[model samples]
Target: MEDLRGAFAIVTGAAQGLGYAIARAYAQEGMRLALMDVQAERLAQVADELNAQGGDALPLVVDLADAADTERAAAQALAHFGTPRVLVHNAAILINRPFSELTLADWQREVNVILQAAFLLTKAVWPLMVTAGRGSLVYVSSMSGIKGFVNESAYCTAKHGLEGFMKCMALEGRPHNIAANTITPGMYMHTPMSERNYPDELKQKWVDPMLLTPAFVFLARQDATGVTGERLNAWELSTNPPA
Candidate 1:
């Protein structure tokens, strides 16, 4: 395994939930961080907490749905830490509105944050990762990525697009030794989004998001030759990592 000590990582949606858990995991691995989120105060608190624990964290307040703001955030990260060992695009918004009730603006915001921001962030970091000769890009996906749900028209569409985009990136990145993959929670978790969406039954079975961070930490050590273009289960991978 690659030595993650002092490695750099950029995590979006890092103010709370799964993203927060991943940030903590990276910190424990001795990785420096550039955390992006819309929640300014919460983001600073997380950064302070990590810094207090001997972790290096730079908190960036950004609205992922705004293309310009997303680009600026990526630029700042690059300036602070030249090339990231990993880029985890975990920022996504889910609004449960029926098709009949959903406005075009509503659909656009969700797609912009989840899909458009993915493209923007990846595009900004692509050259750096290529020059560095190795990198891992992980997009947090879900069952909604492949299956349709009752009130997730925009979300499902963007997730499906995300999978396709990763496939293309994986194919292209293979030549440059950059790995690209999508990962689903695989099991229910106690996240802000889950709290809003999960039923009582799933909540009862839900585990802490921290339990799934091992899979992410493993992926952080990978290159194109290691599990690219795959849709992985975080729960399964964490339970039994690759040999």
Candidate 2:
């Protein structure tokens, strides 16, 4: 395992689900955290819990879909930690509706949160990572980006765009030692959103979000050198990490 003690990380959508699991893993590794989410109360509670455990966690509540809000949140995190060594773009919204039924607003909202927000946040932190000459950017991608899914046109489109965007970022960041990659969680988990859409039995068969923590931790490690612009399977990497 790569040692990440004394480093700092920024995790978007960290109030719960996979984002929360990633943050907890980072905290366990002694990394300070800036947890961003739209849920103010939940974000504060998560931050407080981590801080109580002798971890440095700051909660910033902002609508990530808004470029201005994302920029401000990024500024706050940077001011608090100077330059974070890791950034995980984990915020996403899924409006599951058939293409014929989906409204323009629905498509726009999903795109803004999943693709546009990632762009804004990455842009906000890009300079810092370059200045430090090293960093890691892990995008929380999904199978929706790789294959077509019914009633998920908007989500799929945004994720596909995210993958392409990360590839471009990887090329640009290569010179700066900033690794950029996409991690696709192949199955659903017991997230609040998933719970609403999936039956209990189906959810039980799915992998737990925490099971993918190792993959995120691995990608966030400063020692993770020469790995960029690649698409990773979280389930696979969790059991068999890259050397």
Task: List lDDT for all candidates, in order.
Answer: 0.94, 0.88
Q: What's model 1's lDDT at 175?
A: 96
TM-score of each: 0.99, 0.95
How much does candidate 2 score in TM-score? 0.95
| Model 2 lDDT per residue over 16-128, tens place | 98999999999999999999999999999999999999999999999988889989999999999888888999989899888999999899889998999889888888898
Indicate the residue-level lDDT of 102 in model 2: 98
Off by over 4 Å in 2: 199-201, 222-224
- What residue pairs clash in candidate 1, if any at all? none
Tens-digit lDDT track for model 1 on 104-164? 9999999999999989999988999999999999999989899999999999999999999
**How does model 2 fare in lDDT?**
0.88
